[model samples]
Target: MFELIKKKLKHTDGYPYLLSILEHCLQMTYKRNGSQLQQWQLLDRILQQIVLQDEKGEDPDVTALENFNVKNIIKM
Candidate 1:
């Protein structure tokens, strides 16, 4: 299921959509049982892809912090 979604998103425009899907999968992993490890692994792979796709060549830490800050603001 996750692979299918990821493959579909791979052809689409914008990293925001990928980020949103990653966030959703992260939340689901936390809320579900039995498959937590698999979900985390998938999320890790997705994060790697995001970093590779990043055009600014920013440090991963900085990019992650910026993403977290934006998400926090969106929640508030």
Candidate 2:
């Protein structure tokens, strides 16, 4: 098995082309923090909804909380 692997590695056709394709694949490296749905900008909107109901000073529309769907903004 080792001999076969060595032979395949030494004889890879179009190795340069394969390398160029692999290099492109490495470009999309991702960094992540602990924030799920990292929509930091949307934080203010949600906060206003919970803190200040409306311009007329009504109660917060808390029922809409049940309809909140993270999937609507991002896919798993």
Candidate 3:
């Protein structure tokens, strides 16, 4: 599911509701334990952009996050 979302994020103009669905899923993850949802990598990658941006004091940088990994994604 998120694999498709990841792809669509690059071309959201073609998928109007992608962000809405993404937000809903994100809230769901926060409301429950994310480890069992097969969402670790999805959340990990989605979150890496923000974490990197926060740490570096810059706009979210997907390039910087390509190979990054958060040790404990569920706690983030």
Candidate 4:
């Protein structure tokens, strides 16, 4: 999951679908225990990196829907 986010943040090309994933993830953080659903140190770092890059007036990585191949994944 983090890998996909990192990849998307690196080369999203402003795709709406990809941008939506981040929105969804941000929304999910509102759910009970959702903040702990998944945690990857790399992902945290990637998000930070994306934020820093964005501060430079550049586009951050966006994620595509196809990139999420969820299977039997339950949300807390």
Per-residue CA lDDT of model 2 for 21-71, tens digit only, reads 557546634446533324442444465575767667785666655667655
- Give me the candidate number with maximum lDDT: 3
Q: Write the per-residue lDDT of candidate 4 for residues 1-76, one digit (tens) a residue.
A: 9677767666666566666767766764434454344443334545665675655676454442234433323343
Model 4 scores a C-alpha lDDT of 0.53
What lDDT score goes with residue 61 in model 4? 49
Greater-TM-score candidate between 1 and 2: 1
Off by over 4 Å in 1: 1-26, 31-33, 54-76
TM-score of each model, paired residue for residue: 0.30, 0.25, 0.24, 0.26
TM-score quality measure for candidate 3 = 0.24
> 1 or 3: which has the higher TM-score?
1
**lDDT pick, better of 1 and 2:** 1
Candidate 1, position 59, lDDT: 53
TM-score: model 2 vs. ground truth? 0.25
Say what the RMSD of model 3 is.
9.9
**lDDT for each candidate structure:** 0.58, 0.55, 0.60, 0.53
- Residue 46, model 4: lDDT of 51
What is the per-residue lDDT of model 1 for residues 1-76, given as tens digits with 9 covering 90 to 100? 8687677777778556777866786577353444555456555755765666657765545454443433323232
Q: Which residue pairs of candidate 2 clash?
A: none
Candidate 1 lands at a TM-score of: 0.30
